[model samples]
Target: MVSLSRVPQFTYQKLVHKIGSVDVLWFQHNSLDPELLMPKALFEVEHTTDIQNSLLKFQELRWFFVKMFIVADNKRRTEFAEKMKYSAFSELRNNKRVEFVSYDQLVGQYNMVSAQPSVSLLL
Candidate 1:
């Protein structure tokens, strides 16, 4: 099972675009400025579906997220890497803005992050 945190609010297919729609858009909670309201993190999950489409969707919204995470199961992660264009994969490989994570990794991170109490609560 996948375990992602629900700590912050996110937009799901709320903001439309040409290719289709973003899977999940996570934003920072602050009143800094309207311009700063852009998503801090973008996520595309490909479990049993085509990772290509999910990747394409993230590519379309590359401007929105400061950091993007593409999630796939163990098998698909390798397959997606193999099927991707060399340049595209290189770009994905090079960009810190994008990351590819396996389901187990995600769950582990989620478990680690979510298990801790909020700083606000600690204060």
Candidate 2:
């Protein structure tokens, strides 16, 4: 099986809070209609950034993605956790599919997988 991750480059000029854009967006193509597609997941990288904006962007597109992730740095991770305590953000806190990934974890995972000598060539 061939799986690919599609990252959206175009700006979402239609969203209410058009401040931030999704860094990684994944989609699945229809077997019947080649042109028809649906979003599978989304990822936002927050390195020394605001969590509220990222959360808002994800909230707008939440219905489409089954899984969503917030990848943030150490400082941003703590900030995000604190910001997540709002009553209005209950949706995000209760969602089982949503995930938070720290920068250290992301780096460790990348390093672990790419540790092989041959992997460097592929990269």
Candidate 3:
């Protein structure tokens, strides 16, 4: 289950891009582990906001490449807290709320790049 404490109050301006994928296999394959120490919602949200805004100023195409994906481990709540320190994405990568779409028909044209949130502006 997702730890509500770690769920941040996502802001519109902070969201760079919104990725819409309906592939369950891809999520399962690429999903990172959950953190142990679930960070406070405030902390996660702030981090996410900072991460999002930071990526908006880039003009190069190479920024699109994902350097690394974070996965939380079995340390429980603490794991999440620890992961947050190293998270490199615009939003917190919590496993619980990680949207899982099994059917492409429900979403868009089955494309992975429909409305992806901007992720190229992180440090």
Best prediction by TM-score:
1
Give a tens-digit lDDT track for model 3, residues 29-106. Answer: 223434322121111112223333322222111133222222222232343344344555224343232211222322
Candidate 2 stretches greater than 4 Å from native: 1-20, 28-37, 115-123
- TM-scores of all candidate predictions against the true structure: 0.64, 0.63, 0.16
- In model 2, which range of ten residues has the least summed lDDT? 11-20
List lDDT for all candidates, in order. Answer: 0.59, 0.63, 0.26
* TM-score result, candidate 2: 0.63
- The stretch of ten residues in a row with the least summed lDDT in candidate 3 is 19-28
Per-residue lDDT tens digits for candidate 2, residues 20-81, read 35676556666776665555557788775777877877666655545777888766666777
Candidate 1 Cα lDDT to native: 0.59
The lDDT, on a scale of 0 to 1, for candidate 2 is 0.63
RMSD over all Cα atoms, model 2: 6.3
| Candidate 3 segments exceeding 4 Å error | 1-74, 93-123
